[model samples]
Target chain A: MSTLRRNPLRALGGARQTPGFGDAGRVVPASGITSLLTGITSAVMAFLAVFALALSLSSGQLAQRWSATLSQSATLRISAPPSEIGAQTAAVLEILRTTPGITSTRVLDQDEQRALLEPWFGPDLPIESLALPRLIEIIESAGGFDAVGLRLRLASEAPGAVLDDHTRWRRPLVQAAASLRALAWFSVALIGVMMAAMITLAAGFSLAANAPVIRVLRLVGARDAFIARAFTRRFAIRALIGAALGTGLGMLAFAILPVAGESGFLTGLGFHGAGWLTPLAIPVLAALIAWAATRTAAMRVLRRES
Target chain B: MIRLANVAHDYGGRALLTGIDLHIAPGAFHFLTGPSGAGKSTLLKLCYGELRPVQGEIELFGQSLRGMSRDALADMRRRIGVIHQDCQFLDHLTLAENVALPFVATGRPVPQTDLRELLAWVGLAGQAESLPPTLSGGERQRAALARAVIMSPEVVLADEPTGNVDAEMSQRLLSLLVELNRMGTAVMIATHDLALIRNAKAQVSARVLRIQDRTLQSAGADL
Candidate 1:
């Protein structure tokens, strides 16, 4: 007992130890390689986590852009006999000039009108070829004029004129974009939950596979902490690897996105300045998730063993 | 070094050992002999804190076993070396890694030269890199002895260390235990082989104890 007291670490390094593998002078530690893999997994998971975060951030941006840009624009158009167009245009300008909080109004020049119609009616066409409707752009102050009230008055005062607040046109577009952004965020949340579940399962299976090894370690007096360290380190590395690969591929795909607003469907979908740095955070977040998962699994298993 | 008084153990409502009393003095070499299922192994388990006695007192190094925290028990275990009948090993690991497991568990590193010498002493110098599954029964027993002594523990408790080995291998393993005894380490061997026990008596005085009807007695003692 006195001798054992002097060498109180016997159980941890006691006999009934392994007798095969490595050289006499340099025996390798069993968990060394496994732990390295865990570290790799941690890095990969962190990489993927950045992308998850990116999706969430972009979703919020999309929602805000929809609400902000869609809330404030209106257009007015006048269709009349060729002789009465000037009269209608003058009457519209006079009405706009007297309205409350009417900031500024511009009558699109013939060139601007031609450019607007250029898509369907080819360039260089004679201006008098068809009964062209006169288009006017309006700007309003912070507390702008009431759109509904103005349209009602316009309908009565100028039968050949119509006021469009652009609300109906922009509503569906913004709603669709907002919904798409929400879906992206939902996908990101699902990925995170999946990553956690996958990592947990992987760690648990690995621990089960190494049951014999764990038993021997315990017989030799290993503590729960020591055993947990090996597995936690190992699983974390695995997650890191998977996440990094996923995040890398995600970035590559994002890079090919058409310029924002270049097309209606793809408009503002890509990241803005400094947003590139946003995705870079995925790997770190992935690593954190891996760390949490492996640590949880390892501790759970070790606690039961001890 | 260890004491068990009126110790009783039960498994699944069946009694394995009942009313057993034994005391092992410090720095003593002793042998426990009994038939299979007579609880020799169970007694060792009780002594090592693996299984608690249902009724009785167990004291290790003069401390009561009851109410001892796991950490405290683990601390106590660190001082004693125990050898199992099967000589369990982490098969995936090499011999050296296996031997160094205790060091690894305790969060310490063994010196390379000392490890080499120990392996050489166990006659497994060439098999250090081999896996546990590839080792012969005798070699594994010797390796176990080496690991037990690695920490230079004061007490060594072995359960049927020679059960799987041939006569020749048994002598070699016994010799290692005797040597450890000569070095002032308390040794306890649980075996029913009288020939081996008689042989062990040749060089040094050893007290023999026996278990009968779940009770320990010193009738066959030969010093």
Candidate 2:
């Protein structure tokens, strides 16, 4: 009844039709199991993704903190005969004071040393009785001291003084933290892949279940794009809702977690400040993944059937 | 309009319909009559682009069915409405929605007044909100008829449209098809009911083509 003159080739190739309210999503009947499966899979995957993101970011922060703290300071351990220990310590202290980048120096008192060793040696141990080496702590300025030059100076002035710049141990720790962060991000990627796979399977099942509905639609002159859009829109919405729930729960879990104080690594594994905004993108990403997965599945199935 | 030239279709590696030349022009009325499994449904499917012939070319609206893309075929189908013998409907949607499906499929706005009038004409005004499963056999057939012509298609191909309905309902459905043909919409109904054919011959000049031994033959006017 429409008087509009249309191109025959364009009509054959399928003209783009504006989607009406009826054409939007109600064409396919919503199945209970497939809907629930898609929602639950997206929610669970997004929840795990949030955890992985937190782990990756926290490990990155831990690596940076360790690198900064370890690079700024060095320790000098003076081990010699009890008669020469005091002279060697004095010599090392003099060399450290004249160093260009040395900001301050503090020698650990007996009580402080005892407290450091209390975890292993017990609080009741007599610190004076044992022939303990004298330890000198060196704090460096913003420009770090040259370890090689300082080591050469200490070896000449005080033979018993060994400069421990913390490189050998710090390097490995920082490397391990960096590796952990990479592994966490890899896990997030894996979770996204798994979500896509699950959504694809669910879409396939839904399409098969709605085979009769599809036949009816096709008989009524519904284009493949219209059918695919209906399915993709439904799946994307379900994923968005599910991911929103999962992300909210993840944020709440982090909120109630024990605050990171002087406590070690496990306690610091959470979002900090503006980093809290990162998880909000998860739902959007999940929706996109669902849309792509469902669209692919629908087109494949429709093409095969065609 | 549909034209089949030297079309031959096979089923399970055997010819079901062969050496067929048929044309359903604009405003033409056709009745395909044959025994069960005589390829009446198959021929209807071929006309609608549902099945391709193994030996000949079919043209719908002057465009060759061969080499047409699926989307192209789908778009071409919008000009030709088909009602299956089983009266397929989306079980979740109401009867009104099913009848207006062509509009929905093409993303066109449903003409509410026309939909209401069509339902009324089909004697289904009260059953607008009823589900397909709840409708009686006669009502389902009438609903299918309404759905088929709702798009104001150039042609309507129906397979055994009145197969499960009563004599009165069959007559009523036939009159609707006749009315549509009078309004310049080509119609083709595939059925085995000679009485319905006789009933239709009185009201409209129709061509009755019978499929016998894998070929089409024009029936005599003895009835």
Candidate 3:
């Protein structure tokens, strides 16, 4: 026993021997139903957790991308008469170029404007014939151009220029993405809680079914810790194996998903780079939860018997 | 050593044994005899810290049994071995493993040679690898006895240790208990077999206590 204690992993791996048993870990009879229930439950929970993790990470990436892309740029549209549109666009470009925080600016040509309106209208729409607004795209520096200051300057210089900073739509889009990320994470937490509950119930049933074992152990001068260790160790290993299988299947499913570039937001829901390593911790966490749940249940039942 | 002072126990909310006093000294040999449902097993349980007396102070190894923590009681129990009538065992474990349980429970390495010799002494060296379910009644009783003495406990409590065995096997088990007593381990056997008790007296000086009328009394020198 002292030799086994010196190398605890050996004990866990069933290397420790009893005189005639040849193995020290088979004190508790293996119950096929309990093992199956624990394994299936952990696998299912871990699989769902993987999806939730992917969704959360993807949503967060989407939110940050939207916020960064929209926050650094603004559009100035000169909606004057066709004759004055050129003059107003030129005036807005001059003001933006003179601005300290504005890095670069471009006026959307006829073809660009036509492409921008292609979704709304047909591809053959005559952009040069319509009395459309002239658009100026402004890219800001790291110290972004102040929206209020730029709007004032545009009003004085190009009265027909309406500076659309994209703030009105960007804020809501970022907020929606952030909320999605939060919801996904909450789902992951819910999965963990549900897994814990299921493992606890399983542990409880196992303890009930092995009441005779408990009685015999207690009668033989075995401490509660010894008995509880037997149970906790078994349940923890079961959960670990189950969660690993589930996580592997989930990752495989993710691998088969369409790439982010091919599809859209739904397809973008997966780990990127080092994020793939995140799900590996799920099995470990599941094992910890199982250990805790089984220990608590075992101690409770043993205490009642005492 | 176990000392019960004015111990009174109730079973199912009714008085079963009252004002029972017993002192199991080192190297002492005692036989507890009573009719069925006469509280002999209850007395043995109380002696081994399996049950708490409703009214009394029970002392084991000079420590009071009252208010003892479960772990402390378990530690105390390691010094006292008990053999139940049915010979409880982990059915999944082999006879040898069952015998070495005390060592395993205490986290001590099982003395392989000692375990083998002990089994051989109980005439079960050949059945070491057999599961408990495969053992006969006599084999189970002998296996239980081997388990009880595995730790070389200071006292041995046997609750009808020979209840299911033949006369030859019963004498065999009684002789084994006598041998353990000769080694200075206190022995208490709870049984209703007068012939076994008479047999035990010829081999060793033993005191006979009978539970009669819910009280313990020393038997007359009839045997």
Candidate 4:
């Protein structure tokens, strides 16, 4: 190809016309360098966006886990005299065994009782010194154990049994987690909207400041789209670079976090499996914001000036 | 070539230019002169398609100015070089780069030798690397001329190119325009300097168009 054919400017123009873009990659008006700072801001925004996404996902997972684990299992407690305690426990187990969704029932040994009390009282305390009720550990099948009917049957056979299904606590826990997920998603959306607005404002200021350049370029026969492309491309690249840096830093921060044994939310707010690629999306988010901001500003400026 | 028929301009309903008829054939050197606020610059802007006429007709190379597209007007601008009284330049660029801005904006590849030659011709060869803000008024005017004519346009419109320069510097700038006219480019200089006009008349047969009362007409035969 001829030397003229090899020019970068023409090659920049060969693609879709970017509004107000001067040359494909031609940095005109020297203000194009501002993108470096703006790009960093965009990257930071993307990093935060990633955190927002993680919060939403983790909250949802927490809701799902709470709903699955606590909704099924229920415990039956029988209090009776020393002579009647074993018989009441046996009757409660018999009722549970015939129940459709009850998977298994087991009576706790004295060692387990001592273990449960170890946190509040000293472990060396004599087990025989206190009166203990018979405690049964009930396991429910997949859907959930029937609490209402089982409680009625246990009441008829054993007068002192109390059925605890965990409905009151489980409902509130799952609701709290679901609400948290919604809030996290709302936060991510708000950040995206703010990023769009910031980019627009920045791009608008850029176009406004470069008024003379635009006039000069226009007078020299450049289309409005040509002038806009320079800005759009610059900001997009800046946002992408900024987003990449931010995402990397965010991930690094996440990596050093205390694992499952340490922090609750912090440990959960990280990319997992294919989620690792989630940070890579930071650059693309920045690019999208830059594109939107630059496009709006470029078109408005071009329309008004042209 | 250009033609204007009863061209009147109004800004917010106040007459800035009224009922003006003027013509300049190809290669003609014309001077537009009037007192401050008499609309000399406004006339020049109208002539060059910067400001559209409010109540008259303008034709450039035989195309109606009223119906022209923005792109079409821009293309016409490339053929006409305009130097404003406040010659704006990208302050960050060196003088050489400023002078070559027209070619760059137009996507015309400017040869390095040609740029150097043009700067040298304007006596700015030594200051080529200096920014516009650092250059003196005289240097800026010269640089502006170099920029305006970088593409070798068919017509040149200068709005007080020598307004801020000394007499000697003014003469030097006038000589550059004269040289360009001699090379077949029509030059219209908007200035209040009769001495410069007379000095230019001695070298080239020139016509004076005086703008007054929003109208343009030839000066009295004596002056």
Candidate 5:
């Protein structure tokens, strides 16, 4: 009973028989050493798969966020002499207010201007001393204002006013994020392939080592499916156990990574809310790979023996 | 039932068995005696569907062996039990488990009470929990016999079953075979032991056939 509890499939009802009458032998011997090694390999591969899944999903989210934030806004830079700077700024504001899809507009205050320059220059640098261009922050409505139309209007109204819609930088940033997301997904797929290959190799090794066992089984009238099931079930269960452990460890690692609080690449590399469910698929996938690998190897060996 | 009509089998380049016409009927007990390397074991293998004849038709349970699929052969094996001289056994399994192997192979659960009775009948009730590697040659032979008849097969084919056991143990094993025969199971035994065949002829009406010069013939008035 205790043995069955530890491995429910070990002394299954199918193998048990009326005592002393028929041979109720275990069709295949328990391959502890090979199973352990395969399990460990599955675990490591699953861990990597989990990380790849997280990275791809998070990067995808990052791409969407960047596209949304950048797509909804534009900026107007007025580079006129001090005398005309005030007049050009007023003209640009009046034109933006009249333009369609311009939800809201605001002129940068002295403090806002200084904060924008703080990254490049010292915080204490006098903002009024240099003849910096006056900047206007524009927020677009859900029906975003047209960049080309706005630029044409500004060209005629205020020659010094330059409309910068940020598409030049936004497109590349979003593309890079999307590419990273795709690369992560590709990595996950590659990991799955490698896991299958490793499992197939391990299963082949096990079959070769148990040649005598197979011979005995065939002599006793055991079929190929029966022998294959013994191996496939053992390997599949091992892969499932190992992958579960690996995924847990992987999730733990992701949890401990430095959070990208405001906006950064690594910040988007972690699972959020229901996204945590994604890594759970890793164990199931590993088990399936193990089943396929072991079954193929067992059947091939049986065929060649026949 | 198994039948071979003008069957001939050959190795890569040499003819092993030729011009063989044989039929094994239900509840029939047959003993195939031949010298070493005279196709006695090969003939036994052919009877069990383990080997195909190179030259004629072989039928098992009314189906031709040439046209049977692998699955069909497996199902056919369920009805025919075979024992080898070397007594192949999964060493990792207990003696009881080894006996119940045929049931496992057929995807059926071994009935524990019946299995216990079978082990006791083979005089190995106490050795049920022992491993195969620990068993003596005689014990292994008895265990193999127990396994062979576990499925209650229609026919049992044994090759040199008593080759490795002592004279006393051989007689005990022969008694078990004779008992199976009385219960309506067809039995075929291929052996080189003339003394054992003489002993068996006294207990059961067994027809003794011998193979020599690549031909099968009845050993008239031998027993």
Candidate 6:
């Protein structure tokens, strides 16, 4: 029992790579039709699991990016006739500089304004002749300015100026990103459960097929642990191999994805940095599931049938 | 080495054996003979730790069967070898591997020379690498006997070890059992063949016990 608990693979006659006297562990073949089915199933599930993990990690990164970029800044848009636009923009900039916690402010240059509108309007449009709103970008310190007091001062000084703090849009974007991360994790959990169920069925089939061998071992005074070890070790190794194949293929699939541009959600849809190590755990997790499933099946059958 | 007191065994409310008292000492030799459906196999099962007695206590090597854990019973069973009437063998294994199954079950390093010698003694040295399904009935019996004695068990219980062999092969197997008995290994053989019993009596000092009408009795005079 101590030996079994300490080194399960050794106890199963797998300690040595060669077969000899008392090497009955190979009596149950590690590769067979049932094992093939189990391997294919594990590979498919692990492939899905890798994608789910990548998606979850990517969504988490997306949330962090959105929170960092949107939380500390406010935009001031001044919509006035062509005559008063420059005056309104100058007044808003002055008010922003006087406000506490307003560290820096910048009014957009003609080219920067044109670049921002290039996505919506054609680049050939003449920015000098258009009656466009003058936009002021405001950057806040750790302590942001009081929005209500600043808005009152801006209303009195420049009635056409409107302050947009970006909170209304930030709230929904952060919520959507957080929800996507949760959904991705849920997908990963579902894949694990499905894989466990499939592997359990495979383990049960192997146990049933090896009933005669188990009987002979028992007749010769082999303990239940000895019989169970033979089965669990075989299945565990099979699952590990299958999961490794799946994880490798999945990672290769991720590598070929189209590069993410700066415009949309695809920019944060895959693994990065330390997140690459996350999928490696799939194979080990598969092996653990196989071990637990095979052990339970072997013990139950031996108790009921033997 | 094994004792059963007032042992009663039943199957689904049907009593097959009752009031059975047996004691197997070291180097003792006994033969059990009974009619068909007379519970000969059941009694043999009880002698080892395969089947627990229903009503009475069985002590194997000084430990009560009721008190021993399943693993502990398996430990005791390693010390007591068994040969079934069917001569069950793992068909996937070689004949040599089948003969060394006891050592395998006990997780011991099987000595190649000892395994070779035992197979040669059983007349199966030439067929060591042959699969079990390809062996003859007598060869299977010899292989099972070799496997049983490989552990040098204190007691051996055989359920019609010669059931599938010819008379000549039966005699040869009986001689092997007598030789084991001479080496201080207690043995009990359950068979309905009276001629084999007579042949065994001529070679060794043996006792014959018979089960009749659900009771165990000495059939020494009948033998």
Tell me each candidate's i-RMS in Å.
7.3, 7.5, 4.9, 8.1, 4.7, 6.1
* Candidate 2 chain B lDDT trough over 10 residues, lowest sum: B125-134
Report the lDDT tens digits of candidate 4 across residue range A70-90.
866777788898889878888
lDDT of 4 by residue, B133-182 (tens): 77899999999899888888889999999899999999999999999999
**For residues A237-268, could you state the per-residue lDDT of candidate 2 as single tens digits?**
99999999888888888988877678689877
lDDT of 2 by residue, B115-175 (tens): 8899999998877766688889999999988888888899999999989999999999999
Estimate the Cα RMSD of every predicted model relative to the unseen true structure: 8.9, 8.4, 6.0, 8.6, 5.6, 7.4
Q: Model 6's DockQ? A: 0.29
TM-score of chain B of 6: 0.98
Put down candidate 5 lDDT per residue, A1-306, tens digits, no spaces.
333443354455534423433333346677778888998999999999988899899889988999889978888899999999988888888999899998999999999999999999989988889899998999999889888888888899899998888888889989998999999999999999998899999899889988988877777777888888878888899999999999999999988878768767766778999999889999999999899989999999988875
- In model 3, the runs with Cα more than 4 Å from the true position are A1-22, A75-102, A105-137, A142-165, A259-263
Best by TM-score: 3
Instruction: Classify candidate 1 by CAPRI docking class.
Output: incorrect
Give the least accurate 10-residue stretch of model 4 chain B, judged by summed lDDT: B102-111
Q: Which consecutive 10 residues in model 6 chain A have the weakest lDDT in total?
A: A10-19
Identify the superior model by DockQ, candidate 1 or candidate 4: 1
Candidate 2, after superposition: displacement of residue A184 in Å?
1.1
TM-score of chain B of each: 0.96, 0.98, 0.98, 0.97, 0.98, 0.98
Q: Of models 1 and 4, which has the larger lDDT?
A: 4
C-alpha lDDT values of all predictions: 0.74, 0.89, 0.89, 0.80, 0.87, 0.86
Pick by TM-score: 1 or 4, better one: 1
Candidate achieving the largest DockQ: 5
In the range B14-107, model 5's lDDT, one tens digit per residue, is 9999999999999999999888999999999888878888999999989999988876888887788888899998887778888888787777
**CA displacement after TM-score superposition, residue A98 of candidate 4 (Å):** 24
Residue runs of model 4 more than 4 Å from their true location after superposition: A1-40, A57-186, A212-222, A261-268
Superposed model 2: Cα runs more than 4 Å off: A1-23, A73-169, B220-223
Docking class of 2: acceptable
| Model 2 Cα RMSD, 1 decimal | 8.4
- List candidate 5 segments past 4 Å from native: A1-25, A75-138, A141-168, A260-262
